[model samples]
Target: MDSGATSESCFAKARKSDKTRRSWTEREEECLIQALKEATTQGWKSGNGFRPGYLAFLENHLKVSFPDSNLRGNPHINSKVHVWKKLYGSIVTILSKSGVGWNDTEKTIEASNEIWESLIKVDNTARSMRHKRWMYYHDWCEIFGNDRAVGDKAEHFAAAVQVVLTMTPELPNNVGMSLDELFSVDEGGAESTSVSLTPSS
Candidate 1:
């Protein structure tokens, strides 16, 4: 079966399975974030640039982090998948308000191309092709502030570039510095500015 079918099957099974359900704790959430960071840092990619084995890894961490709880045979991966959807959905909403709609792949590509020009202007010293691409992505998040959920994923990077590309043209000259420090809260809220922008730098 295809991925969509597989996901539906798995979730259906989860819904009927007699698994112990527990509330997510603050420490468990931290462990999830750490696992994600490690996966990204280690260049772990599954289908379509998404992390492979992340759910399994997170299950291991949860077992360790919540050792006091009797989590044996719990459907940890399935529960984590549910949590991931909620977290990822919140991020999608925040990006949408920043003018970076994730549904339009063509628009994302167009924005990425446009943002590349701006990245080059900021970092003309980059020589290697790979290095240039890296710099472009790294600066993309900073230009519009950070999205911790997306982290270092390329597709998310491209969408972020699109958001800034769409916003930059409308910025007033005096607010450049403020724009540099602008960011959206991850709670599905609108973007907010943190600093002032000046022409000098």
Candidate 2:
């Protein structure tokens, strides 16, 4: 019995399992994002983020969309969502900085090499974002922008809320409006109501 051969076979098996676990096609990501949007529309999402069981909903949705994907709610969908939130946070951080900006035409973050180097020093994850196209930036904003919570998870959400409020146009007869009211969509309407952000007394 060759122990070295046995160990190599075990290592190969582990690598194969990991590859299978990490495989996510572009179509699958699109499907997941669509499902998340649907979940938000259905009111599964709230101020604190998606309610419990949303993962199961997403898993079932993906299963129906791709019967052979074999994705699970526990790790596959959960891990992907976590990664997306982190990526979104990194992008938001990049844009929040004075030297960085978003390139609308290229759908990528725009920053000088010096700026990129500075950001990458603070966050190593930003390295991969250089000149990388992020097609789902707006979708991510829609999905996670309104999340209001305490601590680290809410950091990006708070920044995004500020950005959205700054971009929103003021309306006549606007005096006091809560964040919810500002972002609320009219009944049977596809667009969100535009309201100015006013400081609460």
Candidate 3:
């Protein structure tokens, strides 16, 4: 047999394959939005954190796909929440090193900018996972009826935000002074789009 194959053979093999290619639907997005909004409100920033659950819910259920990685990153393990987990981890690092008071409001922007700068330092294209996580957060908010996620991108991670906000002389009226708290809403009936993030952030 020749080493090369014809287009007909390839087509025949594809047709014979048992599995079907997965694509997204609107209903899946609806369920995902509901689950995420609830999770974000009730347990949005859990002890482990938010992004893990968010991404898992999609890949496991809603079927939000991921882009193929040319750089050898774990494509099968990608999700909105997972991206946030990594970004939040980075944010936490910057916060831990800052040693800024939790109640020192003056350092809020400074700490925030540092975190953002660190992110830019890592990737200037603004297409980094951290930046994408922020886009996910912002888009989620827009769908959930919020003008924005609130606070700087640095505030996206609670562990980091808490360190700086707590140091502030006065916390926000919400009382938590963390990204989790600041972005939280009632989530009573917040049903919107899903995390069908199938490539191209």
Best by TM-score: 2
Each candidate: what lDDT? 0.45, 0.77, 0.41
Q: Say which candidate scores most in lDDT.
A: 2
Q: Is candidate 1 or candidate 2 better by TM-score?
A: 2
Query: Tens digit of lDDT per residue, candidate 1, span 90-144?
Result: 3333343322233332223222544445534644421122111121222223222
Over the stretch 25-127, how does candidate 3's per-residue lDDT look in tens digits? 4454355555566556664445323445555554444333323312111242244334444444443343344432222332231335565666557556322
Estimate the overall C-alpha local distance difference test score of candidate 3: 0.41
TM-scores, in order shown? 0.34, 0.67, 0.26
- Look at candidate 1 and give me any clashing residue pairs: 177-196, 177-197, 178-195, 178-196, 178-197
Give per-residue CA lDDT, model 2, range 1-201, as digits (tens).
699999999999999778546778899999999999999999999665789999999999999988887798878899899888767767776787878888888899998999989988987878988989999999989887776432233333334565666777563325487655555445476322332243458
List candidate 1 segments past 4 Å from native: 1-20, 47-52, 70-74, 98-201
Q: What is the C-alpha RMSD of each candidate to the true structure, in Å?
A: 19.3, 11.2, 16.5
lDDT of 2: 0.77
The Cα error of candidate 3 at residue 193, in Å, is 30
